[model samples]
Target: MSTVKEAVDVEVPLHTAYNQWTQFEDFPNFMEGVEEVRQLDDRHNHWTTSIGGVRREFDTEIVDQLPDDRITWRTTDGDTRQRGTVRFESLDDAHTRVELTMDVEPSGLVEKGADALGMIDRRVKGDLRRFKEFIERRGTESGAWRGRVRPGDPGGGLI
Candidate 1:
């Protein structure tokens, strides 16, 4: 397994940053390799992405979530094996720091090679930088889901 961590500070309130992140389907707007994301439900999402010339489709389930704080997810099915968390921290009323940590298991030679070259880290850093620009330009979230998901809650507490 390989891990990549990246962070960026956005010029928005904690809630604004957090809320925008909750709109998973909007990820493609800022995420480089993500082609599309479909929110199956509050806690489930289907993703299509092309990285390193490889296209993959995956399903991910949110495992834990706390409004305006953090969200954690794991890939449930697909060609990818990974888990990650995105956390939001308030720097002040007008600034929020968003941090992302991801653990990925390379299943084949291509993925392993990409990992060895620090491609994942660069991709993550670029994504975060784009996210900062995206949210800052918008100045508000398109939508938000404030529901809390506890550790043992089914479906990550969609309700």
Candidate 2:
């Protein structure tokens, strides 16, 4: 597995940032490679993405979440496995910093090679940048879900 981490600051409140992120189905609006995200439930989702002519689908389970704070998830069964988390840091009442970290298992040598060449990193960073723009421009969350999990809690948000 390889790990990638990135962050961006947004001109939005922590709750705004966290709440917008909870609206998983809205990812494709900002995530360049995300073709779709269907929230199966509060804690589970089906994801479709295409990057560099490679298309892939996966399901993810939210393992942990905290209101206006953090969310973490992992792929359940798929051609590739990944675990990731997003953390919301309140810079002030009207500004927040969002951080994303991921650990992924490449499907094979070709996938691994692409990742090692920094393509995946660029995509991740680009996605975050788009997210920043999306949220900043909207100035409000697409929607919010009062999840069952709390920031330090586990096995609650992702079904």
Candidate 3:
């Protein structure tokens, strides 16, 4: 497995950064190679990507979520097998740090080669930078979800 860790400090409040992240459908706006993201439910989403000419689709389930703190997910079924977390931390009332950490298991030779070449790390770092710019330009989130979810939750948690 290859692991990636990246972070960017955005010029937005913690709540603003966290809220924008909850809008998974907007990830394609900043994430390279992510073609689309469909929110299947509060804790599940479908993702489509074309990385290095390799196309893939996958479904991920959010295993743990705490508003303004972190959101964690794992692949439930897909062409990719990985787990990741996006963490939100307040630096102050007007600054926030967003950190992403992921463990990806390469499935084939192409993926393994790319992982060894550090393509995943570069992509993740670039993605976080774009996210920072995107959010700073907007100055606010397009939507918000303050729900809480624990591992194994069937999707009904209000705080």
Could you tell me how far off, in angstroms, the CA of residue 35 lies in candidate 2 after the best superposition?
A: 0.7
As a TM-score, model 1 comes out at 0.96
Predictions in order: lDDT: 0.92, 0.86, 0.92
lDDT of 1: 0.92
Which number leads on TM-score? 1
Off by over 4 Å in 1: 156-159
Cα deviation at 34, candidate 2, in Å, is: 1.0
User: Candidate 2 — which residues are off by over 4 angstroms?
Assistant: 150-159
lDDT of 2 at 71: 85
For model 1, how many clashes? 0
Count of backbone collisions within predicted model 3: 0
Residue 3 accuracy (lDDT) in model 2: 92
Question: lDDT: which candidate is best?
Answer: 1
RMSD of each: 2.4, 2.6, 2.9
State in Å the error of residue 112, model 3: 0.9
